[model samples]
Target: MSNDMLRSFFLGGFECSSHRRADGVRLDLLRTTTHDVLAGSDYRQLQNCGISTVRDGLRWHLIEVSPGQYDWSSFLPMLRGAAECQTEVIWDLCHYGWPDHLDIWSPEFVSSFSRFAAAAAELIRSETGRSGLYCPVNEMSFWAWAGGDSEKINPCATGRGAELKRQLVRAAIAATDEIRKVDPQARFITAEPLINVSGGSGDQAWQTEAENYRLSQFEATDLLTGCLEPELGGRIDNIDFIGLNFYPDNQWYLGGSTIPLGHHSYRPLSDMLVEAYERYRRPLVISETGAEGSAAPAWMHYVCSEVEDALRRGVPIKGICLYPVLDYPGWENDRTCEVGLLGTPGPGGERQVHHRLLDEMRRYGHLSDLARKAGSFADA
Candidate 1:
């Protein structure tokens, strides 16, 4: 399917993660980064950078203060700001955390999430006079591994990663169905991590283990497409696009260090993109990708180069989103992570632009414009 519905091929994503820490402290990145209060200025900044599309989230825990009741006060401003700026937003319905009153293991969790999605669809259409684009559950595979298996965040359970993954897939499917009932034109994106794992040594058993670990990255996506678990009400039509979240550390060796970018075992991201496209026959997006400090510019350059290569190979690569477009505090240590095009917001929510990275983006934007004009990657 084509992703031409988006207004821009380049997008900015605010750090809207609302997951809780292992210590049971809820982490509201929106508040810590002051984006909750500065969304208007933030969208305006994206427009200045030539980005008319964005990926952001609505805090489900904050919106549904109580069951069957919602307080749109938290999300209304951001939604209106996007509309006013003519920015297209692909909203994340559930980033990581959910209302504490419901048990994630219970059936009520799926039903409640579906209901909330339905309500959100209605609200967005009523306000914007258009159907919404959504990511029902963000990074289900990572969420399962971190929160369910490793106990790194909320619902911090151990030894239940597979179960948690199935639950999340079920919720996503239910949410998609409910949203379609409200607005049949609504589209859903499945944003999952894109990773590669290789064997570090010559041991045969270790090689098999590494390969198995590598392939496990597709479990969540496979389930969603009914390739693994059809009993969960999954089908091919459940997802409209596949959003792959890649980063510098996405490739590694089993139980070993990260593979350097130029290492022999480091697979080119273009190949990974092609593999994903062939496997699902769906258009893809670089949903979340960025780096911190001095490495940010180079990382952006690499991703864009790889994406262009994939596009040239007939892969339906749609867009590239510079995630967490604004600098924010780290989840573990509260240290400032300088990983965005814009630095920390000042007292008035003004941010210092990373001129070098912005320049690279602009350079790539010009190339993309030329490509579009030439009818190259036009459908992509």
Candidate 2:
């Protein structure tokens, strides 16, 4: 089979609402029925678009309230519907929100999360009869960057305090381990934003900060891989797979007087993948990769070609996922709708993709196939 034949594409699920508020932010709580409609529509769209797998979010806060009180009424139907459609679901257990009642610093938080994970795993396995993929938490570093450092989300904290960071990591590890107990065959993908930062001349301090930011992505992965550096070992364990989330604007640089040779431009997504491959040699997946606005198609093709190139060179990349099938409402600065593959519906309700750009992607499918063949031949 060709490389393109072996390679698969996944789409991110969940188009829940999150609007900016006066005092803080408000998450438009998506009920089970609403999710069912969205998930069904997304699955059909993905199937028609040639995507094979779907990455869906299962928010912890939405299912369990206090402790053992579980609410499957909302998510169960959607799961069954996806299964019926023969779509592979990479279940994301916690995207960003926690039960509003649980404190990040409390032991109860960890215990509660563990219980939730085990129960969820059991339910999913029982219903699907497959060891479904699970991401106990999505983008741990990004969560810290937003909630802990930037104070953008709930329980927003600020400053250099390591407590919030530590707690989040702990919760993730606890949840991962608990889920493993219930479904020993479950696979994990620790998805984090592959942020690339740059700096200019006279910005030595900023350059150093940028380097630290890049290193932090690997740091979180290391924790999940159970190889945390001596200073960071109290938090995680080995992950089954490496889930990388990359975007066009995920790279930026600070202007300064003294610039390093490679410090001027953002590192390309290919370079980031090569770095991860060199470090772990695990089966990798671009869990989330897309562009905002009219560049969506071009961005998709660019990222897909990069992944194809990596495959040709023998990278163990398993999949590529376009995030959020629908143009979600209330994106950060209202940019969510623009990142979607299909342009946002207008007053007439028409959705379209740039045909020329999509044709470019189709052309490269052959290159992707060649790469897959190379990898297979090498393995043989």
Candidate 3:
């Protein structure tokens, strides 16, 4: 696919995490933010900011209610809304949650996921006359760490992070294959966290461990590209876009506090982007990036500046997505996280726009236009 595949250079990511919390309450962020009910208007809001492309999700638990049966009732409206608004979306099939009936460790989980993905692809093709872009699984590494290693979320276990990560990779590869069978033109994205880990202490062992931990960030994508584990049915073609989700808290000392942006240990986002592009040689996207209230505008400026620098250095970054474009309730608590350009919906389904972030978006929208022209030159 060309670098211009996405409709816009900037994108809005609707928070669609559907993971169960420690209290056994399954959290659906899309519903929490009311984006599911107001998806059409939500898309229009982004469009007004010149963001025609978006990152959205299909809640697997809601769609695959039973073993073989599928229900799109919870998802169709959002899909139709995007279509109605003339929005381009990269749909995430599994966003950290699954149906309660399936054991995440079982072989059945992989098979069921593949089948569901194929069904979703079929539905998209039928409704929109295009297979579209999809992210088969979101943040496998983080999910494994939170849910399997740390007991912070569902399928809570201890000392099984690696095992869970491999299982998610298998499921992702299976979903890609199945989706391809249904929609041959479909493209896939691997939306993983881009992180930096620094050894705060001078100990050699600490530095070594920190380096290993940092390298582990690429494990999921490496497996998908068949670079590390070929037995999982991974291939180079499985991922067309490398989606890196970065935020202020992404970089940190291995066992200490976060390394603030200006800290010497803090790696520039441009350098990380180039490193990833060189490793995978695939088009990249800032799949998710944003900051909470009061910090949003400055954060966008920083990210856009870094992205432009990376672009100048020959990195093919397709876009930067402002994640959770609509503020939503936090997973661990019900408090609103003021991290989006749009606030919670009102009685009439209207959302309050964060003028500062909107101003920054207007200022940086030209970056996409410039990148598109440059891409045309490169293509020629």
Candidate 4:
């Protein structure tokens, strides 16, 4: 791959959730904690390790409590700090939850979110000027699966079939449209998980189901980009770039030979990038790609190398992001996943594993070493 085409490394930032206290809110503190620590530890680690961009999601639910009321006190400072650190950010507006009052299917919810998105775009532009990226909604397919099909998040409506998918698409459209209105030049990287499924007869069925699940994500993007059949008045021109979030277990199966099989099983990140490129024909980014536990660094290496492979294959891959710079609490379970480059925080704010993955990232020279080795062999 040419040097001009190799995009910068993307590091994940903190993710906040509810569990508020009167002092402020739990999620807000979580963001603050990450900002402080990154400013101290992770920022230098990223710079020393050769990462140039940072990716973090700003929860709509946390920032906006009521319809018109806004709270920038907690989020703005973090963005400013990131900018000062010379790290570019891909701001994710909505991940999985909404403000306590907004219903996904409600007109009020749609209109309110549109206004919120526009306001956010304006603020980001006004604050950062022209050097800002936005992801109005993160993981549309995951949201559909969790809230609509799987009953995981708030307003957990499940088994609703296409209705749930439609709701997600509408929400994305509303958010994207409003953001574009505020900053017409705003670049967007819409992050959605790319789940690969495998197994036997039951596994095949599961894979089929998983593919359908995956379709919801691309479908929303396709609809937004005018690539799919118009489901909601042809509002498909809103998507600019594609952000793919893939995890190790994101590729799974539910039945038959409980043990999964196939080259798809633990797919190399290259294949995922190629899939997105083939489907969308636009610039693609690995928005949130990482593994859990001590394997995180090795996984980061493998995924980043795969990204280089895809670039060599002529895929218009834009960037690779190691999501969640700090190891925050997981939603699936309370245990710390330790997926970040800097290890998870220990009890009472102690750093446990220092530079566990970040050090490895430096050892490999940010995966550029691997890419050079591969290129040399290809030339030979």
TM-score of each: 0.96, 0.84, 0.97, 0.81
List per-prediction Cα lDDT, in the order shown: 0.88, 0.66, 0.90, 0.63
**Segments of candidate 3 deviating more than 4 angstroms:** 1-4, 373-380
Sorting all predicted structures by lDDT, with the top scorer first, yields 3, 1, 2, 4
Off by over 4 Å in 2: 1-7, 10-24, 29-35, 203-206, 229-237, 255-264, 332-336, 342-361, 367-380
TM-score of 2: 0.84
lDDT of 4 by residue, 2-118 (tens): 422233545555554432222322344255445544443455456555776776656676678777899886567666776677766677676665777776777787788778888
Candidate 1 stretches with Cα past 4 Å from truth are: 1-5, 366-380
Model 3 clashing residue pairs (backbone): none
lDDT value for model 3: 0.90
lDDT (10s digit) by residue, model 3, range 1-380: 36346888989999999988888999999887888889999999888888899999999998888889998999999999999989999999999999999999999999999999999999999999986799999999999999889999878988999999999999999999999899998988888999999998759999999999999999999999999989988888999989999999999999889999998999999899989988998888999999998999999999999988787777778889999898888888689999998997788888999999989977887777556544343324
User: How many angstroms is residue 93 displaced in model 3 relative to the true structure, after the best TM-score fit?
Assistant: 0.6
Summed backbone clashes in each candidate are 0, 9, 0, 5
Q: Report the C-alpha lDDT of model 1 over 226-265, residue by residue, as the tens digit.
A: 9986888789888887899999999998988999998899
Which digits, one per residue and each the tens of the lDDT, describe model 2 over residues 261-364? 23436465667787887788776788787765677777777787777767766776777777755555553464345555544444543445545545655665
Better model by TM-score: candidate 2 vs candidate 4:
2
Q: In model 1, which range of ten residues has the least summed lDDT?
A: 367-376
Top candidate, metric TM-score: 3
Model 4 / residue 155 / CA error / Å: 1.4
Candidate with better lDDT, 3 vs 4: 3
